[model samples]
Target: MSKIVYFFCFFFCFGIAQAQDDLLKELDSDSIAKSQITAAAFKGLQICTMQSTKLASKGEWYFLVAHRFGDLTEGFDNFFGFDNALTKIGGLYGVTNWLTVGLSRHTLNKNYELTAKYKLANQEEQGFPVTIVGYNTMDINTKLSTDEFPELKGTDRMAFSTQLLISRKITTGFSMEIVPIYIHKNLYEPLSEEVDNFLLAGGGRYKISKRISINAEYALRLNANDSSFYHNPATIGLDIETGGHIFQLVFSNSQAMNDVSYFTNANGISDGKGIYFGFNLYRVF
Candidate 1:
């Protein structure tokens, strides 16, 4: 009995250690992603996009909670888990308003991912006009042995990710990226062909006032078959800002936010075009 108890304890500790190691790896990826957000690819000198502002308010903490509802295509409920939802939790720091760093973890039905970003521009009270940074994501739940995950059998069986981003503030509330690299895991049954996944995306913000803005982004797949257009995963979002938080309403063809889940795991519309309406909530101190 004593020996058995000792063995169990050792196994438990080993599992915990593995979990921590994975967490650390994700944090490192977040660091790279945040750098891209504020200085490299998807940022602007203004507070028009979803990221926190770069206006420097030292010693402040912020929190953001978001949910995205996944809908079913008409008459496809019997063949898919079409009525579920995904959630994301994130937070940030205002180490001077002009700089912000944050992390977000997205939880899907059976997938998980983490994202991190940092800011390198000051749009509200500006000094320069370039938004520079880097961004990366780690896919923790996109790959597994078929024996362990029987449901994923005959799938492409792989992990996925993307990186390297830098954007510029074109106008007071407008910005764009310099073509960030795209990553995709080849994970489909009848559609297991590798794709030309390179895509281009850019977004902008128009401040109607100090607390309201319009934001949107679109990307088209570089090399893909005709049927793949139904799953290209483009999105548009609207921002409603209050004193210390933001609420976003969005429309997208893709229901997943994890890079792997979004890119390689999309369930295409079998009967017709599938569209979804979702929203996100962002908060900070």
Candidate 2:
């Protein structure tokens, strides 16, 4: 009788210990899953003209406004570009946490654009090293007219851009991104630009404080002609977070905001000559 009692007690304690260990293992697995993803690499949806890995939350709506003033090289002659400002206005909707859709109109070429951005992968704290996002846009140039080219077709006025955005958060306050871009235009000046172009773009951001940061970006055309009038696009900017909106003050060599134009046709040099000053504002609802 005594031996049986001791055996029963031992079995009961063993079962309890086994259940506790399993519970702890389950909790650890949950913790690892929750902490596997790294923090956001950027605050704004864009790192300069290039798109960042950031995405709006599900069901969120964003309103965007941007202005690229005339060349600052014109100085007072153009009131530092205020007199010839080009404006872009757009809206973005987060269809899901991993997908966003946007539409916008630009005054630069009387262009309208439709865009889709989707998340492919996310940076993991100890697993994957980078986050990947895909971006694609279709541009419609309303400024094109039969008056300029009588043979122009509807397809001739359209352009497209596709990009792969890869980024990593290096530290608590520093982040970097690289993008491989392809642009297609149905009609272009053969003497200067290509109907299909490829470019590699890089950009980075450094946070100085919680509300402000410094950012820079540059793009290189992989197959640009030496005789072409276009230069590579480069930009530097400051980002300010105001309560509920993000404001960016930018100085870029390219004045055209459309992706098809921005990456392929820079009007100025990065050395600061002919630079255009601009600002981008975003509000979320």
In TM-score terms, which candidate is top?
2
* Residues 1-285 of candidate 1: C-alpha lDDT, one tens digit per residue: 355335434643553355445446646777433333323222222222223223324677767666666664544662332456678676656655434555556666445445444433322223333444334454555435667666665334434444333455555555555424356554543454343255444555555655666666554554445554345455667667665666777766677765544544455443554555567665555
For each candidate, give its TM-score against the true structure: 0.60, 0.87
Q: TM-score for model 1?
A: 0.60
Which lDDT values do the candidates have, in the order given? 0.50, 0.86
Model 1 lDDT-worst window of ten: 40-49
For model 2, how does the per-residue alpha-carbon lDDT over 156-233 read when each residue is reduced to its tens digit? 989999887889999989999988777889989899998778777899999999999999999988778667999989
RMSD of every candidate to native, in Å, equals: 13.6, 15.6
Which residue pairs in candidate 2 have backbone atoms (N, alpha carbon, C) closer than 3 angstroms, thus clashing? 70-81
Tell me model 1's lDDT, rounded to 2 decimals: 0.50
Count of clashes, each model = 36, 1
